[model samples]
Target: MNRVKRLIKSVPGSTWAGILLMVFFAFAAKGYLSERNIMNILQSTSALVVLAAGMTMVILLGEIDMSVGGVLTIAATVTGMYLKLYETITVANIMIALLICCAIGVAFGLLNGLLIGYMRFNFWLVTFGTMSMGFGLAKGVTGGGVLSGFDTMFRWISTGRVFGIRTCIIWAAIICAIVIFVNYKTKFGLHIYAIGDSEICAQNSGVNVKKTRFFAYVLSGLMAGLAAVLLLARTNSAGATLGEGYEFNAIAAVVIGGTAMDGGKGGFKGTIFGAIFISAMKNGLQLVGLSNYWQQVLLGVVILAIILYDVINSKIRDKKSLRRVYSDGI
Candidate 1:
């Protein structure tokens, strides 16, 4: 009984809520549990899941990266330009294009990290500035147009199924697993949590606070780039507006997954559920005939409610700690 109780306590409440929502939807909505619907949800959510995983690390370090959407667009734009330049499709060409996209992502990510982490600039301001710059560059790349006409192989990767599963879903799962391992099993991950808890304290304890923070942004950028690759494959096209507004969704997934906005208090497991929850909610709402505007409103309400609950839960935990201390003293 004690072990079971401890196990229950170990799981975040948001994770539980997400599970309940899935169960409720499965019962309440016709076809919600169908294999086809499940696959659709997984395929559609793949990119968002990857983005959220990266954002989760950034949030865990108590920083925000507003440039995610722009970075994604930039990556996609660069990939499109590469393909356009080559005018051919080959495994080698594909590899080169992917490398270029990832490099662009890392470059922007590194810039944000250096300015914010080392130069001591404001995180939000720096990221916001970079966001604009990235978007502008993407627009300039194609003169505000779309890039299409990739070979069949490019489309196949995005649309093909391997062992009856979407490739993007597989990519998402792999990324999520890597992030989970990094967060829980690595020394750098430990430093991330420490810095999030208290930067000054972490610094005093010999944690490379600036470097850790910098790397966090880099990881975030890399994920965005990788996500961009998958998204391009799935859509088989790229435009300046690609990935617009995705930053909000990624952040929402992280927050709703029970990762504290204040930082140092979340895990990847909850985030996985959170991503699924968001995707499922959106799909379910559409199926139930909710308009896009109404769906946005409902999502906003849910996010607000979750944040409020987090605030209250934090207060309650603090109170309990105080009570325990007082009781021990007495």
Candidate 2:
């Protein structure tokens, strides 16, 4: 009985919201309950799951990575260029391309980590600046053009099916699983929560605040890079703007999943649900004939509502805590 209660409590509010949204959409949108549509939702949200998983880590530390979109764009663009250069793409070429994408992302991530974590630079300033630089570099490299037309094997990375499941989905699940394990079962994960809850306290307890913060950003960048590969493979094209608006969406997913933006209070499990919810919402809106513009408008409203709810909920929890203390003292 206690275990059941704990399990239920461990589930994030987003999971319930996602279930309700799916129920609503299933009735409202024809064929929404179909396996095809369900698979499509998972496929579309795979990259986002990867991206949000990384965002969860950063947010847990009370920091944000605005440069994720930029990192994805630059990584995808460079990797796309490499793929286009090849007439006959071998497995080796694919491996090299993956390396290129990850390297670019990690390099930028290292810069953000170094500046913000070690040098005591403001995280916002560092991440935003890197975002601009990443986008700029991608634009300059491509000369404001796009790269498209890749080998079949390269495309297969995302589009290929394994046991009737998209490879992208499989990759996302694997990555999310690893992240969840690291976040819950590892020392570093504990440190992330500690720092987010109270940096001074964590520092006094011998947590290497700088190292944790630095690695968090690096992981964020690495995930963006991996997401870039998935996105590139799916779209079969890459450009400077390929990753535009992704940062916001990823952040939205993380926040909507019940991870507090102030940090130290969320995990990747909620983020997976949140990503699926967003994808389902968009898919349902389209099925119901809503325009892209209206979808964007509704999305913004939903994000605001969720954030407001979180704030109110936080206040309520604080009040309850205070009441508990008073009662105990009495």
Candidate 3:
């Protein structure tokens, strides 16, 4: 009994909320719990989980990366064009295209890191600027049209089954695991939390604040690039809008997972659950016959509610601590 209680207590409140959400959906949507629907949810959420993992790191540093969506679009667009140029796509060609996507993403990330981390530029301005640049470049290159009909081999990167499981799911799991390991077991991860908590103090403690911040954004870009590959593969289509609104979804996942906007708290574990929760919410709502517009409104409301809960919960804990301190008279 004690062990069970301890296990329950160890789980975050948001995790319970996620479970409740799934249960509610299972009841509300007739087929929500079916194997097919469950598989759909997992597959659809794979890319999102990967994207949110990187956003988790960025949020952990108390910084935001606004260019992920744009990066994804541009990377996908460029890669799509590369595949289009080839009449017959080979495995080597697909691999090269994958590298192209990641390289573009990393280049943008490096630029963001150099400007914001080393040069001390405003993160918002720099990221947003790059976001616009990425979107604009993709649009110009594609001439405002969608890119589609890539070779089947190219699509296999995401749609192929690996050991009876979708490749995208495997990719997301591998990537999320790596991010979790880095966040928990690495000196770099410690520095990330420390810098987010107090940049000045971390600098005083011999942490490389700038380098950490730089790497955080770079990781975010890398994730976006990888997500673009998955997105392109799943949809077999790339367009100027292919990655639209992704950054919002990624941020929503991280925040919903209990990562503070101010940073220095929360881990990727929460973000993973948060990503699934968001995906489940969307899938369930759609199953419930809600329109996209209503879905957006509800998403905003849920985010606000979670933030309010956190604030109230923090105050209550503070009061309890104060009462204990007073009673101890120490």
Regions of model 1 farther than 4 Å from truth? 1-13, 327-330
By descending TM-score, how would the candidates be arranged? Answer: 2, 3, 1
Candidate 3 lDDT, 1-330, residue by residue in tens: 989976774555667777888889988999999988887888989999988888898899898999999999999999999999999988999999999999998988898999999999999999999999999999999999999999999898889998888888898888888998999999999999999999999999999999999998888889889999999999999999998889998998898888988989998998998888888888999999999998899878876777677767777768978999999996
Which 10 successive residues of model 2 have the least lDDT summed? Answer: 8-17
- Lowest summed lDDT across 10 adjacent residues in model 3 is found at 6-15
lDDT of candidate 2 at residue 89, scale 0 to 100: 94
lDDT of 2 by residue, 272-317 (tens): 8788888888888888889999889988887777777667766876
lDDT of 1 at 3: 100
On residues 68-126, what C-alpha lDDT tens digit does candidate 1 reach at each position?
Answer: 99999999988887888765689988888789878988998999989988888999999
Off by over 4 Å in 3: 1-13
Query: How well does candidate 2 match the true structure in TM-score terms?
Result: 0.94
